[model samples]
Target: MTPIARTRARAVETLSLDATATRNALSSALVSGLADALTDCGKDPEVRAVVLTHTGTTFCAGADLRDPPAPEALVDLLRQIIELPKPVIARVTGHVRAGGLGLLAACDLAAASREATFAFTEVRIGVAPAVISLCVVPRTDPRALARYYLTGERLDPAEAVRLGLLTTTAEDVDEALSPILDGLRRSSPQALAETKRLLTAKVLETFDRDAADLTALSARLFSSAQAREGMTAFLERRDAAWVV
Candidate 1:
């Protein structure tokens, strides 16, 4: 099945994470599909902006344990979203976890439904949110991230907004995004692209500086004994040995 479904409304192109059976997990195939879609949008004259959304109760349940992408691939996908010439907006109306947060952080703007939830669950699985921190750390409030990243605590939409993980939260997410999309449509393509570069320059710099180290750390940790135990326990619907 196609993991990404593309649709358009005038100048706004929407790319949906359509792998509902996996809760849109970032398997290698889904990552490649999304990257290719974003690449096409970046070069398309009619696409002034892109909306990245999902089709299940979970926006993304993080990496697909059974078929995880290479850490480097995840890093490149996040960087691609940040560097895409057309603005990418995350429209989340469901739960997001672990590496999924990286996707949200990479977007130029994000809006979520009040029912949406978020968490950095890597710690619970004996790995750290390493690769994602490249975008997540710089964009979110450091103090809030410190708490959530360490504890793997769940955050509601309002708290996510307070932590700078979301642009806004509304009972109807699409209504909230309508005006933003309208404004994007009215703006000049060159002006929007230049302004996005200005906004994302700091983020791109962090990626350039820390991506290699973070990807290495992620690869090392995911292959660790602790992660093996945690993943096994999780698959078995039990707690890891370290859990008290």
Candidate 2:
């Protein structure tokens, strides 16, 4: 399969981020491919819901900064997911970081495996979760987001659920998700679409209002001297300059 591909089962569309090589980082191609796939699913009458998932152990590791980071695309992708007429469910069975957290926040519902872990790791690399904050800030616990975003603290599943980042956590992802899917299947597609618009209106407003400024904030941080040192140290497997 391609880096991002869509398949269907029982009126549900599964959008799989299949690039395990980079821990399914949001490369430009992968992000665009996913947006396009979601658009296609929205237009298909047979697709009642969407399941956003990954094929490997790490659901997503965040931006692929090997190239100059273009965070505008990630902002757009999160907007797309949040505003999509069909309900999107994040099925996280592994680790998620940085921008990946935005994807979960934008989804209408999300479930993670008990073994899955998460972190807002951008601060450690000297950037903030500026762009993703449009979605995450609203869905996340203020105290939790404040602590984790600043400290880059990793949260286990229960903490994640308590932090309002996940709907449920279980050892069995399929079991955790079965009821949601069944309920989604029982709903009328039109009602689901309209309800999604109602649910997401404020988040979409947040995106439209704050995206450009946040993108600029993220871009500036990525290009900063501190971020340069931090990223370089991370790549070299050494402590960052500020680690003292």
Candidate 3:
């Protein structure tokens, strides 16, 4: 098992991202491990819930772009997380940025430490927050989306809760998530699954109608010289010389 693939059991199955120094960045191994964990948990009647947490201080820094997975692999892992039959809780502690924020959004519920911070930071790095955007769009407030997506500013836990990114702030990581797990334990697993299905269907209904348009827009953005320039400038730590 790679450093990224680490699992421990609390009362429930606790899957911790083990890339601590990298702030538990979503490396390919970690993504695969996470998907597998969720699949296994879904099959186990004994596992009432899954808690997705990290080993170190930080929750997750975001995707490990340095060793990024193929787009298909990335999508598959994210879909597994989103579609898991059992409830998944995001146990956020430190900073959740870019794709990390998206992971939190993908979970059925998120509990963050009062000190945790979040950001939709893809714009700062020049790429659109494409995959995570699908997860975040429905969860976040429409009014705040434009600013956060464009500016890539960090939002504190309080702000994250206000914007629906977090269920609530915890005094500490364990305290924040204890009640959520307790509540899930007492609830009907079958009913939870059904509710998740219903909510997912409703949330996806809006995008199902506009899929083609969205794809075309994304393709155009990717093909543009401005996008290339922005990306290059970000990587080089220089200003982008956009024509317009």
Candidate 4:
């Protein structure tokens, strides 16, 4: 119930994911608050950029398995970030998995430390990355995405950059991002909005066209008995029946 995120000064809004209780899992509050914060950023004339970061060691552990997030909630949040007139940057400093990858993909830019890890882990949980695919598919490398999207294997930040998931990977995240933020700060708000619209036009189209079907698929998969077993096993720290 703690605040999911907040915005700070410097024409920069830092949305901190404060759900350390669940390893910063994407809960209802986190998802809805993200959407609301992004909307606020777009409306605030003083806010030119937003930074998405988390307090926990884990950047985002994906859905709150005990009370999984609705596909619609995630879908809307991703859309809001993509369509936001202002720039959104992801300051990744820890592990990211499942739906978290989607949030990373929605960002206009991302900076991560060299040690962070990432994974597309839905397949292991008897589900698919249906809702998240809208953003993830555009940024992720095809061949690598093909493998990781299916295998649920983990990748290092360097590999993630090679796969186009991260914009910059450095030993120090702030060192990597300071220049990018400065350059963004120099641009006018109107130019940023227009340029972002130009850049995200196709992504927006795909989301409008496919979000419904994708969300439906995600919902169906999560509701299945097999997925229930997988989630239960995951929470209990055991392998699901399907795991060989």
Candidate 5:
């Protein structure tokens, strides 16, 4: 099956991350598939809004260590979500970690189930949340991000909302999204696009200013000895040497 599955209802299109075996990790293939899907949705006049969701217990586990997408590709994917003419909403019902938080941050609106959890696990993996910070830093509370980014502490959905990582959280995420989706469907496409453009201006500026630097930092760190050890330890189900 394809990593991404698309479905449409009314004026909204949903793109589900269907790579359950990888917990929808951002493999090169998954990144390409999603980018292509978003392009199609953007060109479709009927797609007033897009919902990005996942199909497993984990929404996304971050970069696919074994088959990771290029840092540039990941950056492009995140920017694509932010720059899409239609509003991109995230519908998460499970764990999201590391680079996965990038996807959430890039979205125009995000609603997660009460059971959902999030973390910036990059620090633990001997890298930083470099590229994702383009959108994340602009949207979230700086203080809150400092704590989570450094410590990789788990955040509940409500905390995620409070920190601005999520627009809302509910016991029933789909129920919570109903009104928002309906509102989008009723809104004029041009108005929606202009409104989204207004909202994402700062985010896009961040991408333009820092994306190159961050992408380079990501590539550098991922190739470092520390990252190699961290990734090896993670794959071996053991602690990295630096773990104390």
Candidate 6:
């Protein structure tokens, strides 16, 4: 089955990750498909905003380690989402872990269900957050990220919202998304586009200067045996024993 699914309603383009069995693991096909969808949305004058969601109870579990894409490709996929012109909203439910959290973070805005949970579990998985870090570090509060990223702890919906990881929490997915859709509908398309561009430009400006710092940090983290052991332990359903 395809990992990513795409549909459109009015001016909203909805992309659902369909690989529910593996918890919608981010495969190359899924990343490429999403990239194509964003590209299509960019060219299609009718699509004003995009809603990113997933089917079933889980939002996304992270990359399919069994069939992972190259690191560069993964980074490129995230970059595409970040640079997409239209406002993208992540409609999250259940667990948003690792790269899944990254995808949500890349969206222009995010709304999650009350039952949702979030984590940066990469350290537990024997790897650094890497690509996902780029998306999340920009959107999340520095203090919150320090706690979660360092400890690899999961946050509940309320804490996620408090940490600036979520824009709103709804009783259900539909409930959470309704107002966002309405707001998008009320907005001027041209103005929305311009607003998105300006916000992205401003964000880029801030991060560009810090690229070297981020790169060095990521390298140090990724190269550690602790990162590898943590990732392996998590995947194997065992507790990690990494010392700081």
- Give lDDT tens digits, candidate 6, residues 1-244: 5567888887899988888888887878778777777889888889888899999888988877677655666666666777777789999877888888878877888998888888887766666677666767777789878999887898998898888888988788687688779998889988988888777775565446554565566557655788667656767887778554
Question: Model 3: per-residue lDDT, tens digit, 171-233?
Answer: 887876777788888888899888888877744553455444544554565457776777577
- Model 5 Cα displacement at 29 (Å)? 0.3
lDDT of 5 at 24: 92
The runs of at least 3 residues in candidate 2 whose Cα sits more than 4 Å from the true structure, single-residue gaps closed, are none
Model 2, residue 220: what's the lDDT? 93
Candidate 2: the clashing residue pairs are none
Residue pairs with clashing backbones, model 5: none
Tell me the tens digit of each residue's lDDT in model 2 across 1-244: 4688678899999999988988898887788888889889878999999999998899989887774337888887888888888899999999999989988998999999988999998988899999989999888789877999999989998999999999999999889899999999999999999999988888888988999899999989998999999889878989898997
Tens digit of per-residue lDDT, candidate 1, span 33-151? 99999999998998999999999898999999999999999999999999999899999999999999999999999999999999999999899999999999999999988999999
Candidate 5 runs further than 4 Å off? none
Top candidate, metric lDDT: 1
Clashing pairs in 3: none
lDDT of 1: 0.95
lDDT of each: 0.95, 0.89, 0.74, 0.89, 0.94, 0.79
For candidate 4, the lDDT comes to 0.89
Q: Provide the TM-score for each candidate, comma-separated.
A: 0.99, 0.97, 0.84, 0.97, 0.99, 0.88
lDDT of 2: 0.89
Off by over 4 Å in 6: 206-228, 241-244
Error of 1 at 128 (Å): 0.4
Task: State the TM-score for model 6.
Answer: 0.88
TM-score-best of 1 and 4? 1
With a 3 Å backbone cut-off (N, CA, C), the pairs that clash in candidate 4 are none
